[model samples]
Target: MSDLVIGLGGLAMMFALMVFRMPVGMAMLAAGYFGTVLISGARSANALLVTETFSAASNYSLTVIPLFILMGNIASVAGFSSRLYEAAFAWVGFLRGGLASASIIGCAAFAAVSGSSVATAVTIGKVALPEMKRFRYSDALATGAIAAGGTLGFLIPPSTGFVLYAILTEESIGQLFMAGILPGLLLTALFMAAVALVTLKDPEAGPRGEWVSISMRMRALMRALPLVTVIIVSIGGIYLGVFTPVEAAGIGAGLVILMAIGMRKLDWRMLQQAVSDTVGTTAMLYLIVIGASVLNPFLALTHVPAMLGEAMTSAGLGPYGVLLLIIIAYLVLGMFMDGLAMLVVTIPIFFPIITGLGFDPIWFGVVAVIVIEMGMITPPVGLNVFVVKSVAQDVPMATIFRGVIPFWVAMAVCLLAVIVFPQIALTIPSAMFR
Candidate 1:
C-alpha cells in the first residue's frame, strides 16, 4: 500500500480509539508508533518514541506550563479569583445583564493568570454563579456568560494554546502572546455586546444589579490588586523584553505564591493542592506535546501535509476562499474534538498551507486559537459547557448551550473582524517586537 494510504489508515484508527473513549494523547501515540513500525521498523519507531518523550519532557521551555498553571491554582486557592470577580461586579454589575458581563470580565482577568479555559470557567463560575443566582439572573444567561468567557483563557497571554502553537510552528512565544491581546479584548467586548442584546430583547432575562458606592468599588478593586499587579508585571515584563516567557511565568508563579502566603490565604493543604493540580495539568500537556511530536514525523514520512496542500492549491480557491474553508472545517471539528487536541493534530497540516498562502503566521495563530476556543463551547463536546454544567447542576445543559449561542455568534463576528483587519492581531506584536 502507498505510504499515504497507511497514513490515512492510521488516522482513521486514531479516531476509532478516541471514539471508544481512549485518551487523546494515547490515541495519537498509538497511531504514530504503530504507523511508524509499519513503514520503517520497530527499531526506528521505538527510538522515535523514546527520543520524543524525553525531548518533550526535558525541554526547558515547557517549564512555563507548570509555573503558569501553578500561579493560577494558587490564585484560585487564595481567593484571588473571587476578589477579581467582585471588582468586576462592582464596576459593571449595575448595568442591564451587568452581572453576566461582570462574569466575562472576571473570566478575562482570571484567564491572564490561569491560561486555562476550564480553570477560568470553574474559578469565575463558582464565584459569579451563586451571586447571579441570588440576583435572580436567568440560569441560561449566567451559565452562558461564564462558559463563553472562559474561552478567553485560551486566547489571552500566558495561554497554553499559544505556547503549544509556538513549539509546533517555531514562532516566537512573545509574538503570539502579543498577537492575542487585541483579539482577546475584542472578543471580550463582543461577548459583552451579546449580553446586552440578549437582555435588550428580554429585559427580564438579565436584570440590573444594585449600584455600588465608589468607595466600595475602589475597595473591591484594592482587594483584587495583588493578582492585577502580578498580571501586569509578568505579562508586561514580556512585552518590554525584560523577561523571557519562562522567566515571566516563574516570576508570576512566585509572586502569586508570596502574595497568597502573605495574606494567609494559602495554608499547607491549599499549597499542596495547588502544586498537585499543577503537576497533573502539566503532565497531561506534556503528554499531548510528546504525542504530537511522534505523530508529526510519521505524517511527514507520508507527505500528507504536502499532498493536502497540493490538493488545496489545485482546488482553484484563492487565499481567502481557502481560509474560509479552513475556518468552516475548524467549526465542524470544534463540535467533536477538544480544542487543544484539534490544535496539535491540525496545525502541522494547516500552518504550511497558511504560510504558503503568504499569511502572517503570528496573525493566523491568533485566528486559529480564537476558532478553537469556539469549539470549547460548541455542543456535543463543548468542554466549557460541561464545566459550567458541573458548577450549575440545576441548569439544564441545553439551556447553557442556548445561552452561549449569542456569544458564539459574537465569536464568529470577532473572527471575521480579525480576519478582515489582520492588524487587530498583528499591531501590538509588531510594535513591541520591532
Candidate 2:
C-alpha cells in the first residue's frame, strides 16, 4: 500500500524482467509506468508519461549524442582508426611488448573520437591483433592490451557514458568531459605499464616488435595528423570555451566527413552505413534515457533514495566508507549488466547519496565511470574481453580473461589514486570552467 513498498516491488519486478532477457529500457518503462499508476493513479501516470516523453524528445543537449556517434562511425569508415594505430606503432613498436603498448596508445587516441568501449576495442583490435601475431606476441599480452585499452573509450572526452551521466544528473556535459581528460590519460599510462610488467615477467609473451625507421615514423605521424587535429579542435575547443559541447560534436563530425571526402574514401555506401549505424546507436541511447526519465519520478515519489541515504548515514559509515560500499556494489553489478545500463539504473539512487556526502558531482561522475570501465573487463560478463575474443576467435575465452587481469589490477590502482586525490579528476574542469 505504501509508496516505499511499491518502489521496492517495482525494482524487484524490473530485475526479474531483465532475467527473462527483456530489454533494459522496456523493463524499466514497464515497471515505472505500473508503479506510477499504483502510487498516483492512472490519470497522473498518463500525464507523467506524456510530459516525460516530450521532455526527452525535445532536449537540445541530446543532439550531441547522435553527432558524436556519427563522428566516430565516420572516422571508423574513413580508416582513420588504422592510421592512429600505425602512428602509435611507429613510435612504440621497438620496445618489449611495444606493439601492445602501441595498441593502448592507439585506443586512447581513437577513444577521443569514438566514445564506445566495444567500438574502440573492436576497431583497434582488428588492426593491432594481427600485427602482434605477426611479431610472435603472446596471445595473453596481445588480447589483454586490447581489452584494457578499449576501456579508455569510457574515460576519454566525448564519452557517451559521461554524456548520459551529465544528462541524468543535470551536470554540465563540457565540465564532465574536461574532468575526464586527466584521468583518461592516467589510465592509459597505467595500461601501458601493465603491458610492460606482463612482458617483463615473461619475455616470450611479448617479444619486441620490428624497429621502424625514423622516416617511416614521421610518415605515420603525418598520416595521423588530421585525426589529431580534429581531436584537438573538438576537445580543446571545449576547454577554451570556444565551442559548446553540441557545437564541438557538429564540428568534429563535419571535419571527419570532409576529410573522408577529400581522401576519396567517403563513397555513397560508406556514408549510408555510417548514418544508419548512428541512428541505431542514438535510438538505443535515447530509449534508455527516456526509460530512466520515466522511472526517476516514480522513485522520487517513493522517497527511496532519501530513505537509503538516511540508512547509510545512520549505519555509522562515514562519507568515504559509504562511497566505498557503493563502489563495491557497482563492481558486483557490473559483471552482469552493461555499463550504460548500470549507469542509468543506479545513478538515480546513488547520485543523491554521493552529493549528500559533500562530494562534487563532477568528481563522482569520473569515479563512477572508472568503476564502470572496470566492470567492462571484469569476468563473467567482461564485455571488452568478449569483444577481443570475437576478433581473435582462436584465442581461448579464459586466456583473454587471464590477459586482462594485470590491466584490471592497474585499473584498481588508478581508481584508488583518484579517490585519494580527487583533484586528478577535478582540476582541469575547475580551472578551465572558472
Candidate 1's TM-score? 0.99
Model 1, C-alpha of 75: deviation from truth (Å): 0.1
Error of 1 at 286 (Å): 0.3
Once superposed on the true structure, which residue ranges of model 2 sit more than 4 Å away at CA?
A: none
Pairs in steric clash, model 2: none
Among all windows of 10 consecutive residues in model 2, the one with the lowest summed lDDT is 308-317
On residues 37-88, what C-alpha lDDT tens digit does candidate 1 reach at each position? 9999899999999999998888888788999999999999999999999999
TM-score of 2: 0.99
How does model 2 fare in lDDT?
Answer: 0.94
C-alpha TM-score for every candidate: 0.99, 0.99
In model 2, what lDDT does residue 224 have? 98
Q: List, residue by residue over 10-103, the lDDT tens digit for candidate 2.
A: 9899889988989888888888989999999999999998899889878999999999889999999889999999999999999999999999
CA displacement after TM-score superposition, residue 183 of candidate 1 (Å): 0.5
